[model samples]
Target chain A: MTMKRLINDPYDVVEEMVEGYVKAHDRYVKMCDLEEAQGRVVVAKDAGTKDKVGVVIGGGSGHEPLFIGYVGENFADGVVIGNINTSPSPDPCYAAAKAVDNGKGVIYLYGNYAGDVMNFDMGAEKADEEDDIRVETVLVTDDVVSSENIPDRRGIAGDFFVFKAAGAKAAMGADLDAVVAAASKCNDNTRSMGVAMSSATLPSKGGPIFDMEDGDMEIGMGIHGEPGVRRGKIEPADAVIDEIMDPILKDLPYEAGDEVYVLVNSLGATPVLDLHICYRRVAQILEEKGIKVHRALVGPFACSMDMAGMSVTLCKLDDELKELLDYPCDTPYFTQVK
Target chain B: MTMKRLINDPYDVVEEMVEGYVKAHDRYVKMCDLEEAQGRVVVAKDAGTKDKVGVVIGGGSGHEPLFIGYVGENFADGVVIGNINTSPSPDPCYAAAKAVDNGKGVIYLYGNYAGDVMNFDMGAEKADEEDDIRVETVLVTDDVVSSENIPDRRGIAGDFFVFKAAGAKAAMGADLDAVVAAASKCNDNTRSMGVAMSSATLPSKGGPIFDMEDGDMEIGMGIHGEPGVRRGKIEPADAVIDEIMDPILKDLPYEAGDEVYVLVNSLGATPVLDLHICYRRVAQILEEKGIKVHRALVGPFACSMDMAGMSVTLCKLDDELKELLDYPCDTPYFTQVK
Candidate 1:
C-alpha cells in the first residue's frame, strides 16, 4: 500500500469534509439543504445578487479548493460535491441551481467528463421542469493533450482561470448567455499540460489508484490517473518543463508578442520549492519565446490528493480576460487582491 | 524508498527555490544581495518602513511558508535562508537586518534552537559593532512537548502567530523594545504539538530523514525529525486530536471563557480534506471546554515537504493579540481580508 492518506472512515469522507469546510469558512459559505440535495450543496451565504446570474460549479471530491474552494464573493455562488473521483448525483446538481438562482437564471460549469455532463444535464432539466428556471451549461475543455479537437480536451487546472473569468462576468451582472459565452471563450483560450511522478492515494481503495516505477514519470497525465502522452524515466526539472511546455505552446500556437497569465500548479505533495523551480523555467521559456507574462499564480489550484507532480496552465490575455482574472475574490483556499 | 520528491540537483535547491520565489511573487518581494549578507536574504520590496522597527524571521529551509512565506506587508520584512534542516549562516542572518532596517532598529524572531541562536547572535553582534544598528532578539518556545520549561521548548507552527504579532507591532511604528515585547508575549501564550506518520524525504540524502514503518506514527514530533513523546499505531483523526490537544491544552491551561486562534496545519502530504476533518475535532473540543475560538486557520501553514503528518497550534488570545493577529497582511502564502 503506497497510499499514505490520513482519512478516517472511507464512507464518511465527503460529509466530514463538507462539515469541516463550512465551519472553517463560515464567513464565506454555508451548508444548503434543498429538498433532495442531501446537504451535498455548499452555497455562498451572500449569494443571489439581485440582478446577477447565479454561478454554480462542482464535480468530484479529492480536488480540494477546486469546485468548492472557488465558491465565494465574486466567484461561483455554490458548489455541488460528489464522492471521491465520482460525479455528483442529479438531485444535488439541480439543488445547486435552485439554491443560487435570483431571477437572472443560473449557469452550471464543470470539467468535461461523461459522468459530470450526464449528471449536470439531468440536473438542469430537473430545474427547468420543476421551477421553470432556465439553467445554462459550459463544459471546460482545456487539457490540450487529452484531445486535438477543441471541444474534446478534458479540463484540468485551467478550470481556475475559466471559472474566474465567467464568475467575474456573472458578478458584473452579465446575463446567462453572456456568462456562458465568457466561460466558453476562456476555456477555448486556456491550455494545460501536466506530468505525474506518482499516483494519488484513494481513501477507500487503501492503495495507489495506479502504479508507476519508483524513478519514472508520466507526461501529460490526467488528474485522475488517466493515460498520458508518454511514460519515461523522470528527468531534471528543467528538462521536464521543456517537454511539457513544447506541446502546450504549439497547441495554442502561443507566439511572439503574446502576453499571457501563468499558473504553475502542484498536483499535490510537490513542495512550493519545486513549483517555483518549475516556474522559473516557465518564465524563462516564455521570455525566450518573446511572450510577456502578464500575471502569474503558482500553487495547488487544483490537486489530485497527494499525487506527486504538477501542471502548467497558460491563459492568453486580452484586456477583458485580464480584468476578470485579476478581479478581487475571496475563498478559503484562494483570494485575489485588488 | 517510499519517499518521492520532485527536485533538481539537491545542492542547488535553496538557490533555485529563492530564484523561483522572487519571480513568482515579484509583486510583494525581491531578492537581496548584500555584500556582507552572502546573497541568502529575501526582503519585501516595501520593507524599510521609516521610524518602525525592522522584523527579521527565519530558520531552516524545509518549512516553506513559515520562515519565508510570512515575509511581506505588515509581517516579517525579511528572511534568511539556510540549507535544508540546517540553520542559516551568520552572514545572511545579519544581512536580513541590514536590508530591512530604517532609522528605528531591528527585531530578530525565530524558534528557540541552538544553531539559530548562535548564528543570529553573531549576525546581531556584527551589526552593532560595524554599523551601529541596534538589534534585539526573541526566541519562540511554543512546542509544549519539546520541554517542560517554557523557554526550553522548541518552536513550531506557533512561529506564524508570534511573527505576525511582532511584525504588526513593528509596522505600527513600535520601537525595538515594544516589538520584542509583543513577540515574547505571543510566544508565552502559544503552544503546539504534532504527529508525524512518515518522515520527510531529504533532497540531499535521497531517502527518509529518519526511519518509521508504514503503519506507525509518532506523536509530538518536531519538524526536523526530533524525538517525540510517544510512538504508536496510527489512530483515528479524533483520537489523534484527542492525544495532541490534551498536551497543548494542559501546557497552556487554556481555560473556559478564553479565546484562541487555532491552526490545524498539514505537515506536508496530509492535504486540506484531512486538515479540516482534524479541525472539526479541535473545534469540538474547544467548544465543549467553553473555550471560544476567536478564529481558525486550517491548511498547510507549515509543511515538511511531503511528510505525511499535521500539527495543531493554539494562541490563547487577548485584545492585543487578537488585533495583531487580525491585522491586514499580504504575502504570497498568507493574506488577511481586514
Candidate 2:
C-alpha cells in the first residue's frame, strides 16, 4: 500500500506546528482582514504596532521559515500564506496589507506564478477599492529557465534576494516607490534554477509527487513539486553542478567584468555535504569563468519539504546593489548577512 | 554504492559544525570569556559570577546548542565539550571555571558517565588547588536503565532537565552546596528513555556505525547511539509513544498527585510532524496517567546528529521544582519558559 495521510484531515498537525514554530521563533498572527475567513494567514512583525508599510510575502506552508518564518525586524513586515504551492485568497492579502499599513501603502512581493498573481492582484485591487489604502506589488520573476521562453519569467527561489534587498531599504525608511524600485531591481538582476533527485512527498500525499528511478533525478524541478526541465542519471557533484550552473551561467552570461552573488539552495533532504560539494565546484567554475563572486551562501534557502536536490541562484550586482544585497534581515527560513 | 562527499574532511565535520553553530548562535557566548585562549574558540558562557554558585555542563561535540549550545544567560554558566561522545578534557574544564569564576567556587554538573566523571573530576581537583576559584562537582546519575549491576547508572538525555532546574537555582545566587543539592534533586526526579530507527553515522565512519533493518527500529535507544533496551519492527505513533512513555513513567513511577515537566526530543532528521505526532501522544499518555504535565517542550532539544529517533523526558515536579523548571534559559538548542 502506498502509505499517506491527508494533512488537512489531520488539522491538528498544521495548527500544532504553526503554534510551535511561532512560539519557538516569534509572535505571528493572521491579519485582521483575513482572520475571520480561511484564506490568507497574514502575519505581522509587531502585532502591537498600529500601522507601517506592510511588506507581505508568502506561499505554500512547507518551506517554513521561508514565507512565514522571515517576518521580523529588518525583514518582512507581514506574511500571507496559503496551502503549499497554492496562493492565499484576496481577503488575506488585503487583510495583511491593511493591518501593517499606516496609510503609507503595502508592498506585496512574492514569487511570480499565475495563482499568486491572481489572488494577490485581486487583494491589491480590493484593498484600493474597499479601504482606499494604496497597494503596489512587484512580482519577482527571477527564474532563468521559466522566464527564458516567456515574456515575463516565473519567480523562483531568488525572490528572497529581492525581498531582503527591498525589505531592508523599506524598513530603513525607504518610501513606497523606492522600495518597489529596489525590489524590482533585485528581480531584474536575480535568476534561480533548481533540480531534484527523488520527488518530494507532500504531507497530504504519502507517495512521491512524481516518479524518478533510483539512478535518476530531474533538473529544473519547481518548488511546488512541478516537473523539471529534464531528467538525468546519478552523477558526481561536479557533474551535477555543471548541469545546474552551466545553464544558469550561460543564460545570465555574466561577463568577465561582472560581479555576482551566489546562492546554493537545497531542496529539503539533499545533505549539506552535497551542498558544499556543489558549492566547492561552483567556486572553481565561477573562477574559471573569471566572474568575481562577491559573496555566496549555501543552505536550504528554498525547499520542497522533503525533496532531495539542489538549486543555484546568481544575482548580478553592482556597488549600489551590493550594499543592499548585503543588508541584514532575520527571517525564519532565511537569515541575511548579519 | 552509497555515494557521498564530506562538507569538510570526514574528520573535521564535528568540530566545524560546532564552530558554525556557535557563530550562528552567538547570543549564548555569555558576558565575557572571549580571551581564554590566544586563538581559542570562545568559551560560550562562564559560571555565573565566580563569587556566585557556578554550574558547568559538558559532553560530545555533535549535538549543537546542547551541552555547549545551552551555556548562556539563564542557562549553564559554561560548557565542557568532549570529542563526540568522549568527555571534555580536564584542561578545558579547568580553564572554563577560571574564566567564569568571579570569587565564589565553580560547580561541575554533567551527565554521569565514566569519561565525564574522570575528566571533570580532574579539572575540579586541579581548579580548586590552583585557581582562586573554588571548584566542586556533582554527577547526574539519572538513567533508570543503567544500574550498578550494569556497571554504571549512566547519565543521558535527562541531563538538560536537571541542568535547567539546577541552573535556575544557581542563577538565583544559591550557594554551591545548594545548587548541587537542587541539581541532584532534579536528576533524581528526572528520567529519560528513547528509541532509534538507526544508529548515528560517526564522522570517521563513512557509513552508519551501527545497524538496524530497513523496517526495524529499536526501543529505548540512547542519544550516544548506544544499544537500546529493545529492538523491533516499526510501530504506529501510538505504539511508539507507548513503548517510550511506558519505560519513562515506569522508571520514575509517578504518582497520581504528581505534576511534571515533559520534553519530546528529536534525535535528528525526524520531521516536526513526527515530533508533534509524538508530542500529541506523549501529552495524551501523561493525561491518561492522571499526571498533570505542567510544562511541555517538543523539538530537537537533545539530538544524536542525523539519527532518526526521539527520547521522552519527564521530571516529576513539586512547587520548588516547578518554579525552577519554569525559569528562563537562552541556549542555542533551547529557549525555556520564563
Candidate 3:
C-alpha cells in the first residue's frame, strides 16, 4: 500500500510537528530557547517555578503523548525530542536539564534503548560538570518478552506508569533519590506485551519500516519495529490477548489477591472500539485469575505513529504505587482531578 | 489491504465493546438497567443526582469517544448506543431519557443525521407520552459542504464543541430551554470540513466500506463514507488544510476580530503527529485572517474506524460560549480542571 500521511516534506515531519504541537498546546508547553536545543526541547510553562525535583522524560518523536504530551502540571516538567524512532542528540538532553532545574535537582526518565542510554548519559554528565546540577536516571524495561533478563527488556506502554509515579513523586517534593526509587519501583512491577498487525509508515523513508502480510500479526513486537517472538496469521482478540497475557502474567507472577492498574493502550491506528473489545478480554482474564483491578485506563496513551496494533500493561500495585498512580495531574493529553 | 481488526464475532462487537467500556470506566459510568435499553443505554454514575437539566448525547457505535467516552461528571448524563455506524433504536433513546432525567427535564444532543433525528424524536415523544417527562433536543450541523442550507448540514468533528457547551450549561443548573439554547448557539457558530485519504474498513463486510486508490484523497468527506466534494491525488498537509479551511471560514464567515475554539480531529487512522502538523497550518491561516484562537484541541475526538483522514472545526466564541467551553468536566476520555 502507498504511504498516505498528512504531512509536508517528509524530511521536515519532526520540525513541523514540534512547531504545531507547541502552538496548539501553548498553555501547557513552550519550546526551549537555549541555543543548543532550539526545536528539540519542550519545557512546561511551570517547569522551574516549583522547588520540587524537576521531572524530565523523553525519547524519539513518533510516540506522541509519551514524552511531550505528558509535560504539564504534576507530570513531566520537560521533554527532549528526537527525530522519528531516533534518540535525541546529547545537546537537547543537556538543555532539558538546564531548562527545568529548580536548584533542587532533576531526574531523567525514559525507555531502555542503547541510543537513548548513550545520549542521555552524556547530557547528565554535562549537567554535572558544566552546571553543577545533580541529575538521576531510571531506565524503564517493561516489555517482558523482549529479554528474559528483565533489566534488558525494551520499555513500551509501561513507560506511562513509571513516568506518572516519578512525576507525582517529584511533585510531592520528594528528593532526587526518593523520586528515582519511586520510578524504579514502578518499573519493576510493570509488565507489557504487544501485538502489531502492521508496521508504521516512515516519513523520510516514505514507506513502512517493515513489511507484514495484510492479515498477519507479530506477537510481542517492540514499538520501533524490532522483531517479535512470533509472527503469524491474525487471531481473534481473545486469543491474541491470551497469548500476550500469558507471558506478562507469568513473568510478573501476578497472583490472586493482588491488585493492579491496567492499561489497554492502542499503538496508534487501532480504533478505540477494538481496544475496548481487547480490554474486555483482559478484564475477563483478570477476573478468572481472581486478580483485582484497582483502575483501568483504555485508549492511546503511547503510540507508534500510525502503527496498527495494541499493547497491554499491568502494574502490580502496592499502597504507594496506587496513591501515586491516582494522583491528580493536568496535561494536554492527560488530566485527572480530585 | 485486508481488514485486520482485533475483534471476535463481528455481530457481537457492540455488545462486547459496551461490556468492556462499563468495566473499564466503572468509576464514572454504569450500564443503564432499563430492560428496554439493556446493552444499549450507558448512564453516568452521577446521573439524575443533581436537580439540573439532564444531558444525553449519542448516535452510532463506531465513533468511540464521541457519544460514549463523553458520558461522565458534568458531561452527558447518559448515552444511547447503536450498532456500528447505525443510529440507535427509539427504545434505547427513550431509556436514556428515563435513566438521566431529574424532575427538571432532559435534553437530547447528537450530530445531524437523518436516522438519528428520526429516532431521537421518537424517543422524546415516547418519554412525554409514557413518562410525562419533558425532553428537548439541539441537533449539531457543522459540516460546511454537506448542504447549501446550514441547518441541513451533517455534523462531524464539531459535535465535540456543541456537546461540550450544552454539557457545561446543563451542569451549571440551567433549565432545559437554556441548555438547548446553549447547544443551538454552539452548533450555529461551528463550521467544519475534512479530507479522507482512505476509506474505513467495515467489520460486518470484512472489507473497506468504499475503495479509493491508496494515494488519493477526497475533500469534505463525511464520517461514514458519505460523498465528498472533490476526489483527486492526495496533497501535502498544508494544501489539504487550505482546501478544508477555505470552506469552513467562508461558510461561518469567521471575522477578523472573532475568537474561536479550534479542533483538528483525526477521523481514526491519522496519526497525532499529522494532526498537529494540520493544526499548525490551521493556526497559520487563522492568524492571517486575524481570528484569534481561544483554545485548540487536536486528537481523535470523533472518528470513522480506521479511516485515514482529519477535519478542522472552528467554533466562533462569544463570552458566554467561552465561559461554558472552559467549564470543568470529568469523563473517561476528556477532563478539564481549574
Candidate 4:
C-alpha cells in the first residue's frame, strides 16, 4: 500500500475533514447545531434565506468540495456528508432538511445512486410525517455512458451545473417546486464522461480501492472506480477527449447552433496544465460544431482522492440556465463574484 | 516511465496552455499583441487601470493559475509565461511591462530564483532603455528552508499572499514605491514549508522528474522537486505538521497573540479533503500557541503538476496586511467578493 494522505486516525477522516472544512471556510459555512444531525450536517451560514426554498445537497464523501463545499450563499443551503464513496445515513438527511427548512420548504438534490435514493427518500418521508415540512427531490442524471435510459444515468461533474442552477433558482425566491424544475432542467441539459488513469487511494483501507494499470486509461469510468465502456492503453489527450465528447455531444443531440457552458474537471491527481490542454480540444470541437461556448471552467471541481483522471462536462445553456449559472455565489472550493 | 499526462506535442505545451488560458478566461485576460511577445505574454483585460501602478507577475508554465491565473481585476495586471520549470525570456518580460504600464510604473513580483532574476532584470533594463517605463521589483523569499539569509530564500506558495498584497496596493492607487514596500512587507512576514511524497511528472520527459520509494516523504522541498531538509518514512498528518510548523513558527518567531492568515496548499495530487485535514492540525497548533487565525485558505493555490505533496504557508498579520489580503479580487482560480 502506497497511500499519500495527510490524515490521522483513518477512521476519523470524515469528522476531521468536516472540522477542518468549517474552520477554513467559517465565513461561508457552519456545522449543523441540530442534535439529530450534529456532525453530519454542514449548513451554509446564509441558509434559510427569507422566502427562498432550502437547497439541500449531499452524496458520499471523498469527492470533496462537491457535496459539502457547494453549500454557501446562493448555492446549497445545507449538505449531508457521508463516508468516502458511501451514502449518508437517513437521520442526517432528515436533519439537513430540518435545518434548512424555511417556511417555503426544502428541496433535496443529489446524484442518482440507489443508496442515496433509499436514504434521502426516507428522510423526506420523516420530514413530511414528523414535521409538516414539504421536501422535494431532483436526482441528477447526467453521465451519458452510465445508462441508455436517461433517468438511470449517474451524475458526474454535471452535478456542479445542476446544483448551481437549483441554488440560483432558490435564491431568486423560487419555491420548492420551481427549484426542483430548475434542477431537472439543468440535469437534462448536462452531460459528462471521464477517463481514469489510476484509482483513488482509500484512507481507511490504506490502499487503492481498485487497481488500474499505470499505462492504461478507462474511458467513461465513474468517480468511485466503477467500470467504464472501454479499457485500453492510454491515448493522446485530444484522441481521448474526442472519444468521450462524441457520445456526450451526440447523446444530448446538441445542435450546431446551441450554446454551452464547458467544464474540464480534474479527477484528483490530474493537474491544471493538462486540464487546460484538454479544454483546448473541447473548445476546438465546439467551434467546429458551430456550438458557442458561453463560459469555460477548467480545474478540479469534483475529484477522487489521489486518483489520476479527468472529466469533461457540458451544460447546454438557455437564457434562464445561463443566468442561473452566472448568479454570484461563494464557498470554500468555488466562488463567483457579481 | 509510467507517467500519465494528457497533452499533445510536448514541445507545444506552453503555447497551447497560454492559448487555452486566454480563451477560457477571456473576461479577465487577453493575449499581448506585441509580435515579439505574441503568445508569451498574457495581460489582464483591465490592465493599465487608470493611474494605478501595474502589478506584473510570472514564473514558469507548470504552476498554472499562479502567474497567469492571477491576471484579472484588481490583481496582477500582466504575466510573462515561460516554459515548464523555466523562466520567461527577456523580450516577453519587457513586453509585459509595456503592456500593463499605466502612467504609473510596473512592479515585477515573482519567486526568488537565479534564472528568473537574471532574465527579469534584463527585461526591466530593456524596458527602461526603450519604452522609458520604470519597472520596480520585489522578489518573494518565503520558503524558510531555502537559505539562512532572508533574501536568499526561495519562494513557494507564499507567493500568493505577497502578490495579492502588491496587487491590492496597486489597485488602491499606491505608487510603485508603496506597492513594492507592500510586497516586501508581505514577503517578510510570510513563511512556507512543504513535503513531497512523490515527484511531479514532466510533460516533455513523459516521466517523473525524480524518484523516491512510495511511502517515503521529504520535508521542506520546493515545487520543482528540489531537495529538502529531511527524508524519512511517512508520518501521521499531525506529526508531519509538527515537524514542518516548528521550523516555520520558530523562524518567524511567531509569538502568542499574533494573528495569521494560513494557506494549506496542495502540490497538485493532494485532495481538498487531505488539505482540510492538514489545516485542522495547523489550527490546533496555532490555538495551542495562543496565535489567532485571521483567515484560512485550504486548496491548490500553487501546485507542482500532479506531485503527491502539500505545503503550508502562514502570513503573520497586521492591520494593513489584513486589509490588503481581504480586499476583493477576481481571477479564474481565485475570487474574493468582499
C-alpha positional error of residue A178 in candidate 4 after TM-score superposition, expressed in Å: 0.9
lDDT of model 2 at position B37: 24
Q: Across residues B1-338, which tens digit of lDDT does each residue of candidate 4 receive? A: 48888888889988888888888889888999987675899988877656889888999888876778888887888899889999999999999998889778999999999999999999999889998999999999999999999989999999999999999999898999999999999999999999999999998888989888879999999999888999999889989998999999998777799999999999999899998889999999999999999999988888999898899999999999999999999988889987
lDDT score, candidate 2: 0.67
Which 10 consecutive residues of model 3 chain A have the lowest summed lDDT?
A: A247-256
Q: What digit string (tens of lDDT, one per residue) describes model 1 on residues B211-246?
A: 988778899999998999999888888899999999
- Regions more than 4 Å wrong, model 1: none
iRMSD for each candidate structure, in the order shown: 1.6, 6.2, 0.7, 1.1
lDDT winner between 1 and 3, please give it: 3
Considering DockQ, where higher is better, how would the candidates rank from best to worst? Answer: 3, 4, 1, 2
Clashing residue pairs in candidate 4, if any? none
Tell me which of candidates 2 and 4 scores higher on DockQ.
4
Q: Model 2, retained fraction of real contacts?
A: 0.06
- Tens-digit per-residue lDDT, A34-95, candidate 1: 77688899999987655799999999998886878889888899999999888999999999
> Pairing residues by index, what is the TM-score of model 2?
0.71
State the DockQ of every prediction. Answer: 0.63, 0.13, 0.87, 0.78
What are the lDDT figures for the candidates, one per model?
0.87, 0.67, 0.92, 0.90
Tens-digit lDDT track for model 3 on A1-338? 77879999998998999999999999999999998785899999988889999999999989986878999999999999989999999999999999999998899999999999999999999999999999999999999989989889899999999999999999999999999999999999999999999999999888899989889999999999999999999989999999999999998766789999999999888999999999999999999999999999998888999999999999999999998999999999999995
**Per-residue lDDT of A153-229 in model 2, one digit per residue for the tens?**
77777876888887777777777888898888888888888877656665566456666676577778777766668
**Candidate 2 chain A worst ten-residue window by lDDT:** A1-10
RMSD of each: 1.4, 6.3, 0.8, 1.0
